[model samples]
Target: MAPMGIRLSPVGVAVFCLLGVGIIYHLYAGVISSRIAALRRRRTVDLRELLALSVEAAVLGGREVKRAREENPLEKSNGKTKGGASEKIALGDQSSHRKMYHLIKNTFPFLQVNAEERAPAGGEEAGVWNHVIPADLQLVGEGREVSADDITVWIDPLDAAQEYTKNLQKYVTTMVCVAVSGVPVIGVIHKPFTEYTAWALVGSGSNLQPRAPRGGRSLRVIVSRSHAGKATRFIQTAFGNETVVHTAGGAGYKVLALLDPPDEQYEQADVYLHITYIKKRDVCAGNAILKALGGHMTTLKGEEIDYRAAEANHGGVLASVGRDHRALLAKLQSADSHRQS
Candidate 1:
């Protein structure tokens, strides 16, 4: 049987083409609209939600950290880093780091993240998301628009490797910091062994309780235990002889001492003073947390650190809680004047 074909007139052909074009255009427009909606969702992230997510991620990472430590005890790592023992990664660190990296990436795919640990060393357990916002968190503004270019997430899966190696899990912490336009706006510090997490959103609020503020003379200063000799000498000369000096490991641990304080080695810290160059990730989270508490962190010369800088190294670190930040700097200045004469 021969097939019969219907030949279309010129006008009919034009109509058919227009119909095809219209269909294609509609499909394309639908796709574009969907894509735009997706982009908008990714671009706008609630700071509170980020804080909650960060706490969840940190808690999840902490589980891995504890498992790693228990499965295989960390022998003291032999190395050196800036101002303290070198950054030592163990089975726990790698696994925890990988877990944290994926969780944040999956949740906030559009964010640029900088993590201390890069790859997973071996097989490990995964984590579940529990978006936990603090009960006491009082968010500042209802909502503020944040552009994509202004946000970066900093992750340090295992903060106190040295202490961890020494079986001092008290100093160990898993940290996350969210910075916008070079300003750290959100921070989460989780103590794996203790199973406690502290989170803060800048210009918002945190769970930090009101404590009796301290300042001026008789200031209790906290410095790095690995290299405290120089710092102790400098701090005493700058502040005064009566200033109490306590030592601790891990920048995150030190910062925590400034807030709630620990009962042991790093006790009663009014301010955390590090007179050596250090990485931004080490301080970014703590800095954000302190900022939320109305505290301040700066360089030795009293200059604010721009967390967005490409070169992560900054010249020393000075963080003070409550009302003593400026006063500490002024005291240092006075000491400098006395020395110059």
Candidate 2:
């Protein structure tokens, strides 16, 4: 029989307290999730707009390159200069390309603004945000800034220069990254040319969800199909020798490859990390999505990839599931050394 009075045991009281805390945490999580979702919506729209501008720039740059190439070198050589009386054409196609790149690069601040605006005054947020930027893409780890908020975006508007220059149908303009400070969270890789987008939200436990034009397919490791070099071989060996590598161009495409299904040419695997040189212009939009999802991203050497400095060689990147695969990285490093030797 039950007691008439409200007989509560000590354990019962403790359990009630725990339940109350859990309820509070649940509500807090809901609120935070909602805020994060709104941020993502705004950020994504901004990125798409920038990407459009970048593509336009690339098209215009291509025209310049073509015109410069056709600038009658023979006629200039035939003319006479002050020394030998010859007139130089000095067609500035390269200069035009640089201007186009800068146009896209300069637009990063608007996408993820500085974290200083959101951080508490006089807090320990210094050197934590990005404020520098890079001058070249061939190099790594340059020009970027650090902010109070732990978010970054990586974008490569025109990947596969050969394909892009050739006006190939398969080329991709991509944007992707490891969002937040270090965790590889949500990621978005969209192919503007094809109107295809791949996104994933990674947390403690990983779940692969899909978007339109396709159903939910599990996220996988997408690599360069054509550039099957020592690095690719090592990845295949670790994840599985038979792992399928997708040859999608562009940084954004690679990030998307982690989530997007394998088309007729590329088969998908079950792991991915969209690592990039720590640069703001290359990462902001994609970082927002990755953070919102769940996973985190960092350099292969396991340090915070700062965005405030402006140089290009921030070492390589490692983004994946489960725990950090240091062993795989070691293998790649070893392979690289062996190849060099």
TM-score of each: 0.79, 0.42
Pairs in clash, predicted candidate 1:
none
What's the distance in Å from true for residue 5, model 2? Answer: 99
The clash count of every prediction, one per candidate, is 0, 58
Per-residue C-alpha lDDT of model 2 across residues 1-341, encoded as one tens digit per residue: 97689868999999999999998766555434444554554443222233234334444444443454345223122254222212233233233334344333343323432221111123111111122221221122222333324544333333433334434434444433334454434344444345444443333211233323222343345544344464466556445565555555433444444344443233333344333333343444344343444323345554445653333525555544333356546655665566557
Model 2 residue 268 distance off true place after TM-score fit, in angstroms = 2.2
Q: Give the TM-score of candidate 1.
A: 0.79
Alpha carbon lDDT of residue 5, candidate 1? 92
- Which ranges of candidate 2 are over 4 A from the true structure? 1-156, 168-171, 174-189, 197-220, 236-240, 261-266, 273-287, 311-313, 321-341
